[model samples]
Target: MSDFTREPFPDRIFEDLGGAFSMGCIGGFVTNFFKGMKYSSTKMEMLSSGMLFARRAAPSLGTSFALWGGTFSCFDCLMAKLRGKEDHWNAIFSGTATGGLLAIRGGLKTSLKSAMVGGILLTIIESVSIGINRKTIQTPRQQFKEYQRFVQMSENQDKKSRSELKLSEFK
Candidate 1:
């Protein structure tokens, strides 16, 4: 619910799945352009180095972009539908986790063909998995609820102790 915190799994999955194919396609184009750029390294040694670097860096970069893009896009969609936080940035923040997960999963194994496939799958699968996990795990709302409960309990105990002290003084 809060920025960059885990959201409900169902929300993640639905949002990711809903836009995975289209967004993944778009992501794929950006990814491919970079991939081509890497491949065009002039020196053979540089090309190899670039390839290695790309192999390592592409996944991280792509995933980050996807995560941010997907999270925001999905968040935007959710906002539009729910009439909540229609602010542009909040929507973008919302889909970050899902998009990042998709990028990591998809980008890790990127080739021109594979990137496309991976991007598509990442969008669909990662969103669903993130959604489910968010539900099971310590989401922001859940964490806040737990924190509130702890505070309330601590306060109650303090009050009870004060009451007991007053009673003992009277006795």
Candidate 2:
């Protein structure tokens, strides 16, 4: 079978799960840090506050991560099946949908807000990542061509400046 038609490895799903879990842990820590600061003046108090917040945040964040990551991954698989490849649009839509659904507990207004934020954030992240990846993967010939173009432009600029200087000297 062609590479395009080949099935994805099942192990990737576990990888996604692990990644989501780690991200959730980090999110929980950051969230708890700020929360800890509000009520904690002393170092010891802050530490205890953080610990308490973390304990509470872990399960909620874990569930959020699982739902977000799992939904996005599933959407990616579906997109690949339909389009022969996945794209950023799929990620944005899936993230928005997941966020909105997760926020259903808070009501419609909250869900809409969450969806908008999630969609925009994911799109920005994915766009930046794609831009960076494209920049990093330049072919040697492409690099050489860009270098040559730079050199030619510099030469032209130098020639023009020299000519202008000579004209000034004559005047």
Candidate 3:
């Protein structure tokens, strides 16, 4: 059986919804933190202001989450059906569509700009994550050997520096 066939649809929808909600909340928090810092005089004031902004931003954030979740889920599902499997390119196209739709309230120009930026950012993030994950799967013994090599190199450099200092003293 295919991987998608093994997983039920409702579960996938729920997972996407949860991820979208979390991303929206985090984005709101970070945006408000900077806004608060710009307006508030002290650290305490910034904290208080950010919290207040977040409270006020909750409804809009929730709406954003719903929209993004629905759009991404639909597009991803469509892409999966077309390609017979999901991949990073599917994610990039879906993310770009989501971004553009999310900005539809602003205007066509804004939608295009948001789509381009969001697509680029998503591609970069996905590429970096893939690269990191690929490099992080070494065995414990391999990691230890790499660390030892690094230490040995550093020690050799230190000894060379010490020998140079000793030779300078004789001048």
lDDT of each: 0.58, 0.77, 0.79
List clashing residue pairs in candidate 1. 9-131, 9-132, 63-103, 67-99, 67-100, 71-95, 71-96, 72-91, 72-92
TM-score of 2: 0.60
TM-score of each: 0.29, 0.60, 0.58
The number of clashing residue pairs in model 2 is 0
Candidate rank order under TM-score: 2, 3, 1
- What lDDT score goes with residue 124 in model 1? 66
What's the CA RMSD of model 3 in angstroms? 10.3
Candidate 2: which pairs clash? none
Winner by TM-score? 2
Runs in model 1 with CA error above 4 Å?
1-44, 84-171
**lDDT accuracy of residue 24 in candidate 1:** 51
**Candidate 3 lDDT:** 0.79
lDDT of 2 by residue, 29-128 (tens): 7887678767787876887887777778877797778767876667656655676656677677767777787788999999999989888898999899
Worst lDDT run of 10 residues, candidate 1, spans 85-94
Model 3, 76-118: lDDT tens digits are: 6777778877677877888888889889899999999999987
